[model samples]
Target: MSSKMQRPVCLLIWLFLLEAQAFEIPINGNSEFAEYSDLVELAPDKLPFVQENGRHQRSLPEESGEETDTVDPVTLYSYKVQSTITSRVATTTIQSKLVNNSPLPQSVVFDVQIPKGAFISNFTMTVNGMTFTSSIKEKTVGRALYSQARAKGKTAGWVRSRTLDMENFNTEVNIPPGAKVQFELHYQEVKWRKLGSYEHKIHLQPGKLAKHLEVNVWIIEPQGMRFLHVPDTFEGHFQGVPVISKGQQKAHVSFKPTVAQQRKCPNCTETAVNGELVVMYDVNREEKAGELEVFNGYFVHFFAPENLDPIPKNILFVIDVSGSMWGIKMKQTVEAMKTILDDLRTDDQFSVVDFNHNVRTWRNDLVSATKTQIADAKRYIEKIQPSGGTNINEALLRAIFILNEASNMGLLNPDSVSLIILVSDGDPTVAAMGEMTAGLDNLSINHFFPYL
Candidate 1:
């Protein structure tokens, strides 16, 4: 309760921000790779996050390979991003070419942030007239190979860091002076429909200024695209206009900001292109049953109809008032509760269950979402304070009992939807209690999360 539950900082082998910091690969004067743990005890802010496009103006250590004052010694020549989306599945490839403009060997990192759930399929690096490809193998085989490489004095570093919805992959190499390194990374992911639209997001963070940075995307859907729109990124660097070429079944979207356009200001060297490029669109679904497709003996189907009347829902709000959620967290939750309660439909039946060390309820049973009931719920929420321990499983069981009892009394509509929203931030103090409902049969669970 004394400290905030902040997001854990992921380090290299671990590596975003709209927070670009040069994660210096801890390599000594020799070619051998030093343990990343040996890296200077630099805080996230203390790390070189060059406000000048991450190109520090300070003098480099005598052995850091480069000695330049005007530009970063590692100059990015070209960064090309291309992706082909077929039937909502996209495979994107990112390629970049960089040349060490220093007389001494320097450590350079090739970093990219991608969607969290996406899987990296392939990664390759070419430097000094040789190509190296990374492959996945059994742990034992990988360990044996690593042992052999270490014995032969070969060293390389590859690390990845993750946040809520994005992951950053960083590859570091020690390049000889004036040598060029080409990096290629391939990743794949499916753009699943969320809240009725499909979105494809691309993370763009060219740490330093780039001369040639281009992005090309092609979307092909047999069902045909209904709409395609791109919103302004990074405060309308392009004056709120995004050029998109769209057609019935296919579309093309390209973004090529010139070096001058990439700057934060007219003449400033700092970059203003460190954010997500998003594209949202919908596909045609002819029937309420949606579509069913069969490919190579595999089948996938979707059915979510919106033309019918909205089903009344039996909703239960299980909120946590644990000590971990004391100040700002509780205030935000209270604000969100006001909005959520306001969104409840008049026909919906809802109740509030607040728990910490003990379970408490505003009402013994569900109540219709009349104006008076909603106002009462808001008052109850404002009075709830954070203290004691978390008891998640107990709160959930209480919800089930209330809903079931309403059903038994014939107060619940047979066609009504059921939802139990649990807002908690700590682990339960009780043991596994999900199976406490062994008496109930024919139960199914469906999870719905909103992300754009």
Candidate 2:
């Protein structure tokens, strides 16, 4: 026989064996293998195979029993964030909607991140027109209930976890096919003061979101808005600048993505507001004390009482030298302290108190912040190193004693702005004077500052 004829004969024998094996099925009556028959029957239509007649042929098997349906996954549809800022605090609300695009019901999880130090409350979920609401509970009780629900395999409730600079919360809820679920979260955060401006940051990066995303912020400053500045990154992404009211005491800012804006890269996501939305407003620093600014029948009074002599200030800085502050944290602290010392006025008297397991002070008493004294303070801060455990109680007590002695010497007058800036990364591990509880009580009763 020729070699070509032998090759065809071998191929034919192989094909026969494959066909025989393909038709052999196990008849052990195992229900688990019942689904296998469906896949086998779908081979002709799903597989890419040629027929013997030199034509491409495909056919689906006829229904022998009930037909199975396919389901789609749930997806986020839209997200909105709204903020209202007053003189002291800012209230933010987030609303999101999720849609189940499947033919079968689904249980979906929704997660959100909020800024650190922001108090989150008033969480509500709406499914099928029925609303479920939750409130802030004690940590212990909330944890117990959350655990109980999970152990029972219940698809409900939520959990919160705190990260370095933010708190993340997640919740799970079931939704019917083709139905939409809505969630609302509310939180309040104190406005940050830097230099001469009050700032608020709204984080907008949740994930790849729908086309209808928007953020609206309204700020009402009783001190009267002197200037409002928005970063350049928000040039075309947002609109409606700080529109001051007729009285110039209230302002409104709105940010909405431009759907028709051209993208720099064709494949990149559209120019959505993916970063923090920073809103800064400069207050009228020259306003005299007892000056009133009214808007919409609401009145705000300033109480700085200008025309009097500028009060001398006595400042004390309590710094932490614990193990956790060994690297970047310590470096940043030292740099900030240097800048702060440089900014002190000549009339200001200041002292520095640093602690690890033992307390240390730069000077036994308050010293005027002269050019030489400020330079020396900076040098002392630079030479300090991070080590040992945190002694919060001892360090705070030493600060209090210094302030008291300065007051006894008539350095801290009635009109002076005596301030104590406590900087620490961890709780107290060693308390020399007493336990942490008693120390806190004493500090709270004896030490009170309008701003800390």
Candidate 3:
């Protein structure tokens, strides 16, 4: 071989060897050694082998080798979920118990799925009477703590939320043989408005059935409650008909499944819930007041007051066009905006502000949602292309300014609803001056009203 080629080949081989050695080194020297020592101490008798050059050397087994026993994975012992819906806010609590039935110690991964738009406020896990709880913190601070915990082989927490309306909570817990662990998760969600009635749903598909499963729902409404409905598929699953209290102010719904009951179903899977349960309430339109209905242990409340004229609204939609919202996200955003614009009433007025690093308005002022105006707005939304960095503070301030100008010009009525809807997937990455928080506060105090 030529000397030039041989020289480069030798250098490449040396570099590869150096990279391999570097990767084998412990990230934290003391912690790694302690972890290895703890494992050796725990099972010195079971490990019939010796360490040679950092690798285990196992001895050959005898002719009559001892049989090895297998351990079952952790089983969900009990799952109990309860929800309370008042007005448009729903608070849900879930309690789950997991048991390690095998003789060997096990590390179990627990996952829970939450509906989109729900905010998880608290989570707690208890193992052998030792409790670990999680609380909300700034993103940067939370990331730092998570990194530290993972490096030290301690419990690290995270949440994965990618889709529009779904989030998954995943965590790991170690359980000793014959021991049990308990987890409690609490969250809040706002019910979205449908044609007439408001709706809320509880998802129960966790890929495994609990030995004991139960759900309790309570509905409270100061207004009177009307008719309540449950799916026919779950009719045989509930304890009894929903019990509605007199005056229709409260209701309750309960569901409990016995082991024998689930066994009787020929097509029922051992690890899966047979079907999802849905609850619906139809409010009495003639009541002209809010109504509450209770059945069994479930409750539903209708909060739309009657005998009042529909209020006109001035809505400003500030949309994000940053690089991250390039493909599917931008497509979905544009489609949703088109649907919303089409649904606006003739008396309602709206304006669109598409923003990236800079902001562009569809019009100088809010325009009535006439047929022609709606068509023009749809065309404008169709042409919006994703680009640049996120400037949430600037975009929001621009919206507030437009609304304030409208109010000053007497274009907005005192009785009308004025709202600014700011949509963005990323935080502020560009700021012209002051802090982003201060800029947001100024916008809020001026003309931004909070909406679900």
Candidate 4:
């Protein structure tokens, strides 16, 4: 690499890393676990490929009036990602620079599949010498603005969509021939600790190789990180190793695979960088009270108790059988239920509540998930027919009522974990949904432990 080619990208990476900031919320921990409120959604974790030169694939006329025989090549000028984790809250940013190869206007698409729980906070595009930044607005208004920008050949991004284990969002910009465009996307998420470890999973699928590509991660765990390992099993095949440096409470991991290593084969220029780079670690913990850390007006509690017997679960399922879920949605729900019922433990008690305009239960109360009961549950799930409108609030309340009644009657073990899993098409009002969930949680807890 020449000094002549180094200044801009290096400066950009330096500035971007310095700008990556998050609320310093750290999770203190011990081996065993304590949890948040009663209700817990288990931790799940891991982009689409960037499409450049897709429309410009055809041979283009050269400056000398000769037609280039091969497809127009896309130039990925630079690629960089920086992740800064304070305690367990992480701020991540991805930056890429691409150059338009031909002397004609072309569309460059930037898409990435991010962790499902992470929310994109910022996105910007620098085209030629002009820069455009994203802003939050009402959906209708945002769409109208995006349309205007698209018409004016400006750049803007919107939306994150949920996928199996990841959600994706994309943005595209029209660049003039010889235009150099730089795209940056930033997001934030809290690292979750599950089964005694916290995972910092980064999804990587560049689809092609670039001259400069790197991922840098810095982590600070005040309770102290007990262990940190870079797992290469994020995807099928590829080497995803990082250089690790460590101190008592801080660690740095950098991965900068060379172009030779990024190639599919020694003689091939095709990229082999298509997999996740997983960093898994756990923090120090206390046997009692877990660990707590406070700094800069914010705090986080890391609690996972160690060596406790597994608590049996009283699990309740809330499924949507509304008109909108009439086809593929309902079909997938039934299929998922079929698999889940098959996995229930013998000591676990479970029931299902399916709702549309009205709510209905598969059983009068929770029952031990015996083979017979599991089989019956699967049958009931398959028979569910989608109709009418959705009743998300009432359905949640009804499910909670059943669990509380069962607990109060001694049918459910007070020592067991009570859980409600809702599978719905979608909620129209997010705020109301949150309120109802909070209210039902309080109701269930108060009913279960009336003296408290």
Candidate 5:
């Protein structure tokens, strides 16, 4: 052979040998595990993937993603979960069935990641809930395991979520190939009033080959609350009660108990204790709100309310600048007030009373809008800082006096509507909502009015 041709052939052979040596995948019989094919050449124990483009591309110490995407070798794994919850206490039981359907002898390791808020009460597992052994351990975050590979290095642990009043529990076990295993986990946790979604993860280690992952989750929310703001879905029953799920999701089960008054008086009577009036009053709200106008052709007009004679021309904003109103509340309140101020007309009069420990009026009397006064008032509101305790009663009483005095002076017309905007997160320490009722006599109040 020519020297040049021989040299070229030698170079090609060398390149092929280096490539084959660098990347190696273990095949188990006929079924080539897709997971094994996807793995990178890192520390065998580490089980990190080789990326073609990212920072870990062809690197020895590879970055492992938070969770692996391989199905557990134990094919017939079943999860049975039952939950019991009250206003205070929550209990959950999970029974897992894992069957080793793989050929040949293999030692399997199991691991589970539980949610944070849960307090583990019982964790037990057996081949058929009869006889089996397992070890359960709790480690902080990251732990290391050894593997056979060119690069042997440590990797950071999985990143768990950071939330208050949350926790986790796990159990580890090893099973020989062709054997079946069962795991039962029981836990009790403190129930939270807030509604949201919670997620938990389960991981299985098929040592040196690939890792398997599973996700379990629980959704917690006041079921009917989501329907509150949505229109035409619910009707208000007796005493402003929300009529949830008429015939769907909620079962229709109601029985009116027989009473002496109901049996005796079967007709209309206006007396308070009369049986006839009681029945009528009990069902009046639902009947009125739930009735289909025009044979279900017309949608319910929930926004309908008795309109006051005069439209409100003067509005007094009584704001609470308590410490709790620091971040989102302060920022949102300021933005809302600016929008309210912009809506005021030339004929409309406005004033702001800010209260924390003590009441402070931004302006002594109702300031009529002129070009400059409105601008100055906007600037003044922008600089108000939120701090201290709430004094809603004092601020409300002072606002009533302001409105009364303005009306007496003929500055505020009796024919014009008066509105007092009270914005606060809580009731006062010294004076409560009942104490402030008398002061709200002449003001027309509405909340979540959907003005837009």
Candidate 6:
């Protein structure tokens, strides 16, 4: 091409670039941004670029039903976040990059929902001197932090920005063709009392960011509080997060509780010979009802109610020392066992079975509830460490066998009633109960206990 032709092409490209820059970066002169600057102090590092011309605004794409939910075309984009706890102060920043591809001019507006606990303290442009400070005269929904400060009430929480100004708040940028603008924000959060592990989600209202722009969440717990469990540790991606040691405050983890009884029984009227016996300690109150007692056969039950006399019950523990039950489970179990030992009366007889693939008996024979026997049981329980797969049924059968053998030897008092408490985290793997079994036939008699 001739030099003259090349010069014209170069000039055209430079003009397009200049136009894009002019629209993408704008100077804000508005009250909304001013009001945001008042309550919260602005930091220069956290400010976002303002949209000067219509070129920087994002237009909503029309979606077929197959694409996703419907959205407005001119909503542009917005960043919003709020704190839930009134006692804690929180701030959230939203950032996005807008790109213009169409030839026609476009603009976007962002809407944000402020949580009850927080308020905007500062709003400013990082690159330019566009300042928007909240006017003390303007009324807002929640009691403002500054207002609380003046009243000298517990000045913990703050208010937040409700709406993002499109044309004025520096959100509206004119995008001609193939132009883009980056919007960034930095939010500050302060809390009164350290909030426990909680969640705050931030995302562009559907029409805003690109279809693939993911919602990112970064949770920061109070100094002493720790995250006990999370559905997924990876950031938006399904990967585990690094495990960190917890502080003094314990983390709360949730797990589904096993149902103690089947609320609806298929064979309601039918009775089985091997009656069901539920003997639990530290169990939920609703489980205490002896629905299994209705079987009306030989069944013995013993329960350590929240407040009950610790007498007449002799317990033999068959604990699974498999590889699985370790760490917190083992530690908690041992602590509870110590408490149980303290509750035992001098006359109460007790024995211990520490089983993995095989059994290790604390006592060769059933031991009387003498102080010496109780101490020995405690020591044995303390020494138990998980090491193998759980054979719950095997452990129970062995425990029961030992109890029966003791009864025959005139060691266990048949009238006093005896219990074999099975503690296991895993279900039965090998050795299970046969098709038929008999014992505790008299509902007025003995008890069976199983703790999961």
- Residue-wise C-alpha lDDT for candidate 4, range 66-131, written one tens digit per residue: 221124455665577778787788888888777677767778777776776676677777664345
Per-candidate count of clashing residue pairs (backbone under 3 Å)? 5, 1, 23, 14, 6, 48
Give the range of the ten consecutive residues with the poorest summed lDDT in model 1: 30-39
Candidate 2 lowest-lDDT run of ten = 7-16
Candidate 3: tens digits of C-alpha lDDT, residues 1-452: 01111111110000001211221211121110000121121121232211123322222122223211122366665667777776556778777776676777788666667665676767777664445666554455556656765565554555434333245566665566656667778888767656666665676654455556666666665555676666655546544533333237555566665544443354444533545556676544654455556655666655555456788888889888889888888888887788778889988988988888988899979999999999999998898889998877777777777888898799986778887777667566788534444323323332221221
Best by TM-score: 1
- Over 4 Å off, model 4: 1-70, 144-166, 234-236, 245-247, 264-270, 309-313, 321-335, 342-347, 354-361, 379-419, 426-452
> Which has the higher TM-score value, candidate number 2 or candidate number 4?
4
What clash pairs does model 5 have? Answer: 45-147, 115-167, 116-166, 116-167, 117-166, 117-167
lDDT of 6 by residue, 225-321 (tens): 3233344322222222222232343221211111111111332321111111111011112346421221234332322234544446657777767
TM-scores of the candidates in the order shown: 0.73, 0.64, 0.59, 0.68, 0.34, 0.32
5 versus 6: better lDDT goes to: 5
Note the Cα lDDT for every prediction shown: 0.69, 0.61, 0.61, 0.65, 0.44, 0.40
What is the alpha-carbon lDDT for the whole of candidate 4?
Answer: 0.65
The alpha-carbon deviation from the true structure for residue 405 of candidate 2, after best TM-score superposition, in angstroms, is 3.1
lDDT digits (tens) for residues 1-452 of candidate 2:
01111111110000001111222222222121011111111121232111123222121122233111212265554567777777746888887766666777788666666766777656777664445667554556566656655555543464555333345567666666666677878887766666667877887754543434556677767667888876645555445533323237766666654333222234444444466787777666664444555656666554444456666788888898888788888888888788778888888888989999999999989999999999999999899889999888888778878887777677665766776788777567876446434223323322321111
Model 6 lDDT at residue 446: 22
Model 1 lDDT tens row, 289-362: 77777766666675568767777888888888888778887888888888999999898999998888789988
Task: Please give, for residues 209-270, the per-residue lDDT of candidate 5 as tens digits.
Answer: 21222112222222211221112211211122212222111111111112222122344221
lDDT, model 3: 0.61
> In the order shown, what is each candidate's alpha-carbon RMSD?
11.7, 21.3, 17.3, 14.5, 26.6, 27.5
TM-score of 6: 0.32
